[model samples]
Target: MFFSPLDQFEIKPLLILNNSYILSLSNYTIYFILVILIIYGYTIIFKNNKLSSNRYGVAIIALYDTILNLVVSQIGRQGGYYFPLIFSIFNIIVISNLLSMIPYSFALSAQLVAVISLSLALWIGNLIIGLYIHGFKFFALFVPSGTPLALVPVLVLIESLSYSSRAISLGLRLSANILSGHLLLLILGSLILSLISTSLIGFIGGIIPVIGVVAIVILEFGISIIQGYVFSILLSGYIKDSILLH
Candidate 1:
């Protein structure tokens, strides 16, 4: 039986908690737990031991340093105060993306609902932080520096709209990238399967797409890492803007 390329994205219930409650165990829930466990394991492994001598430990330490530098550079010295949050976000995202690359594994990052919900929560949290720190002055974010009195209304409207769109855009960007990459892989794999199942000539023709599939998998791994970095950096920028009102 030929399954649809998108079938891999289906969220199947693994165990029903209560039929009436609409809460159940799913592949997503399983993978989500796996992500948390993986992060926790890494933290436990790298906790306070000398890492320079061990190759695996050194690599993990380097990753930590890289993330630390990223947060500090993007958000300034105060960024260290928020280092835990930034580090957690980066690790969770990158790990989840990497897990999705495993064959037959669910891609939590590709779920629009999950990504959008996370984006909205973080965006709202930033707003709350700004409001707590700056009070009414938080609204001043909608006004650019040195705006003429005449264009105040126009610029404020434009800025407000742009600012509000961040939640949608951030989540959409991650979901779109992962969804497209996986879709392409599924299509290519399906095509190769179909071709090889046919005559000898078709099997030979499938080699080209098989090569393309391999290339795309490598590209996808790089993109998965990059998307995590991009998400964290953008969040850092948002945090900085909220604190500095720039």
Candidate 2:
């Protein structure tokens, strides 16, 4: 039924209460709540159990340890204070992304507004943390270290722009990757479907395209985990920067 690749991103309300858009329960809400439940279930299932207890526990715990180590290395022992935040963000992204890979599931991270809002909030939180720790000196993050007073103004101006751009770039990077990958899969699937249905030779040749689709799907799965890890690493760095101001 999709006429365009972008049509996949169109959100439809499942329940519009009181004839008000504001009160509408959209598909996005459902997927988000589902993601939350899945994450909560994961915690309950894995948090209190031994890895040998469940078949999935080994892989899940390994993943938890990987992110755990990532935080500790990037932010040091104090990373424990923020590990939960990073872990939650990383799981939310990884779960939503993996969930979207399911046939007909909504891609929550593909929504620019949702992804950008989360990143923007984190960026603002970094500013607050920096201000809390360093006061007005936090603005010195724009100045770097040891520059001539004459070049300070020009360098500060450039650095300020770059610093602020993180608010948009962090989320844009994640959302753009998710959107483009899903779009590619959908387009390829559609093309192969048409090709295979056309004639005998086309059906035979569909094997390669089908193999390519499988390969890309595997790559997308890797991207889901890699993106989550990448976001965590960058956020850990930003938090470190906020605290250290170096």
Candidate 3:
């Protein structure tokens, strides 16, 4: 068995439903459980007495914060209309990432399946939203707001590549950052543990590693929120540009 802190994240089958696939749960169950906890936690945050009220408050705050940040950073004051979608996406991503920090938890953000699903959903959803808002004009997103007529062919090809690449890039951005950070924590911790025995020198070496591990944990916690925010901001920016022709 691996000795890293994250080694406990292995998946175990809960039931074998079929030959090809089995229903299994992962140590990361804690993360998903925390998500449920967060539902109640929000009630506390917003001082809402009822679960329904808390859910509503959570939705409202998430949407407003995400949209407000996107407007300030990427789209300016004119980006207010996109807040609802942006906020929902931001809340989900932020909550998902944060939930992964619990012991034996799986960071679904590290999985391509989870990340790709999220990106694809956002892409398709935004495309639909843009179409709904702009009608046939949404297709115009394929064309740049400004380009020399002669360069339209090259620009179109470039834009197409960029458009398709968004899903992969967005997914990879979160997955890579999360996986690498966790892996680094594991490696450094193991290396420290290996250098010294469990005796005095070992304990001394472990002190440094313990501190390092704590720092890494804290750093990942911060990054979990940041990754979610970045994903939300980018989504908002994309929508703003698509709608405003920026």
Candidate 4:
């Protein structure tokens, strides 16, 4: 297969599937498959007789690093219940984001389908879980429990708007960051390559941008993990508020 500065979009070698509707195998599909395999492998590992006593503990570690970061960062002692949904989003985004770090692998995080799906999944899942846990009282999230009735309607409308906006905010935050990082790397690589093709002076000029890109890459790498944590932590807070009527 051919390689490019932005080739992470290609289908991974492990998965084989036909696509009549789309031209290429979806990156998100492959990412989810990886997630499944990791979880499945962990399940088998923990099933060994010697390790069976720690299966519950091992299962948590197997899911997603993003989820663990979130629980540790936000929920503290209260993160247990939200692990499943949080883990799914965390694993998908982390895998998608990290894949783009490698040259020629598709950047699933840069695609709207992947990022938007993550945000929507979290938003809808939170709402459903909240309703299931708290019944109609989950709507109470819009109005703080102690507020006077005169303030209730406005509070509800404002909170509802905020709630509805979560999907876009969450998706855009991650997708935009990943997209910007990839574009910056591609532009720098192009400039350096072009400069080398031309003359020594151009080649020297390319070094400046290359250095800048390297620094930015390191910074962005840390930010990627931070952003993933932020998404999960916010979800945890939302769940806490929705369920606790806070």
Candidate 5:
């Protein structure tokens, strides 16, 4: 049991080694493995030959269509080639966020380090993609059209800072949302426990918080989906900007 709401975020070592904790497994490793297995199972379902013959497969196809449309709309015909990458990103993140809501489960998306690392990698990958395709032309990204001569350097510096900040801000958006939502749920759960365990009057009033908890759970689920979609869209846009100068 957690003594405080923040206690749930504490990392606990799951495996002990011979006097050396430097490489021991932890809760994060276990949960990441679980998430990987879940993603692997989902890929198996996606690969089944008879997938299109069932309702689940139909839904899967619909989701694929949505993603395809998103990629094409944002990145154009070239974007179709990157569908696999975006699909993996969306799946891993959505699954991680959803599975974390399960009781006693570790929330990978809530971890700042993990989220920021992913964002930083994506940002770097985008840079590589841009430079690979356009070479020195990629530097044009920092320049704005119709800029006055005196303001060119100032605008370039400002643009560069804002562009680089996306790596941190993008991941922070998801991590902060997950952390805040989980904190809220924990607080409400504790409140309900205290209320129901109090006097008879408090027990009766506990129903209110129970309902609130249910509502918040539903809201969090919506947020999980929305965050996945938002991440995909923003990533697509970033990739688009990288690939296409100006």
Candidate 6:
């Protein structure tokens, strides 16, 4: 049987709610709920508990410290106020990415629509903050610090385009990386299966692709974590720009 790598991305309905309106629960919804539950459970477990001498507690503390340091370094002391938001974003992305590595699990972050919606929301929120703080002066973002009077309109247009593209670019980067990595894994897996099924000789030869699959899987895991970090860093940078108007 020929397996379609793209089939993994299909959004199949799991439970129908209202057939007339085509309302139904899908894998995405279930996985989203699971993500929420996991986050909630972790918080509940670690919320008020004293940090134990165990490695688990120490690891958690290190992660918390790393995130706090990142926010403070990137967005300054004022960024401390936004630590919860930044932490939530980082955890959600990291968890979703990690969950997608599970066999037969849906990759929520790989969905362009979902990622773009999040990016647009964050981008708009940052815009609102900037405008609220700077009022009309926020529009100054479109004009470079030093430019000829004749180039004002052109520079503003260019700047406006670049600024607006952030949402699309950020989302596209995450979705593209996740989608490609998963697709490559699926292809390699299918190759291994096909080779194994062909003949005894083919089965022996299948070891090569199997090894490739294992290596790629490890690489994908690292990529997933790095992507989450990258997303958080970019958000922090955006927050910095919003606050400093630079």
All models: lDDT?
A: 0.88, 0.90, 0.70, 0.70, 0.87, 0.87
Model 4 C-alpha lDDT per residue in residues 1-246, reported as the tens digit of each score: 436665564445443447343545555566656756765665565446665357665554454454666675566666776677676666556655665676676677777776787678777877887799899988878787688899889888998998899867888888888888888778877777888779888877878878888898888777666766677777777777656656
Give the distance in Å from residue 53's predicted Cα in candidate 4 to where it truly belongs. Answer: 18
lDDT of 5 by residue, 61-180 (tens): 888889889999999999988898998888888888898787777788899998999999999999999999999999889989888999999999999998899898889999999899
- Model 5: per-residue Cα lDDT at residue 108: 83
What are the per-model numbers of colliding residue pairs?
0, 0, 2, 5, 0, 0
Residue 43 miss distance in model 2 (angstroms): 0.3
Q: Which residue pairs collide, candidate 6?
A: none
The estimated TM-scores of all candidates read 0.93, 0.94, 0.75, 0.74, 0.92, 0.92
Instruction: State residue 83's C-alpha deviation in candidate 2, in Å.
Output: 0.7
Candidate 1 lDDT, 1-246, residue by residue in tens: 114546447777877876843788887888889999999987887765676778888888888899899999998999998889989988899999999888877888999998999999999989998999999999999998888999999999999999999978888899899999999898889889999999999989889889889999999999999999999899999999899898
- The superposed Cα distance between candidate 4 and the true structure at residue 103, in angstroms, equals 0.5
True lDDT of residue 151, candidate 6: 100
RMSD of 5: 1.9
The residue pairs found clashing in candidate 4 are: 7-104, 8-104, 8-105, 8-106, 9-106
Q: Across residues 137-162, which tens digit of lDDT does each residue of candidate 2 receive?
A: 99889897898999999999999998
- How many angstroms is residue 225 displaced in model 2 relative to the true structure, after the best TM-score fit? 1.1
Which of the two, 4 or 6, has more lDDT? 6
Give the TM-score (vs. native) of candidate 1. 0.93
Poorly placed runs, candidate 6 (over 4 Å)? 1-7, 18-23
Which candidate has the highest lDDT of all?
Answer: 2
Superposed model 5: Cα runs more than 4 Å off: 1-8
Tell me how candidate 6 scores on lDDT: 0.87
Alpha-carbon runs more than 4 Å astray in model 4: 6-28, 35-73, 76-78, 145-151
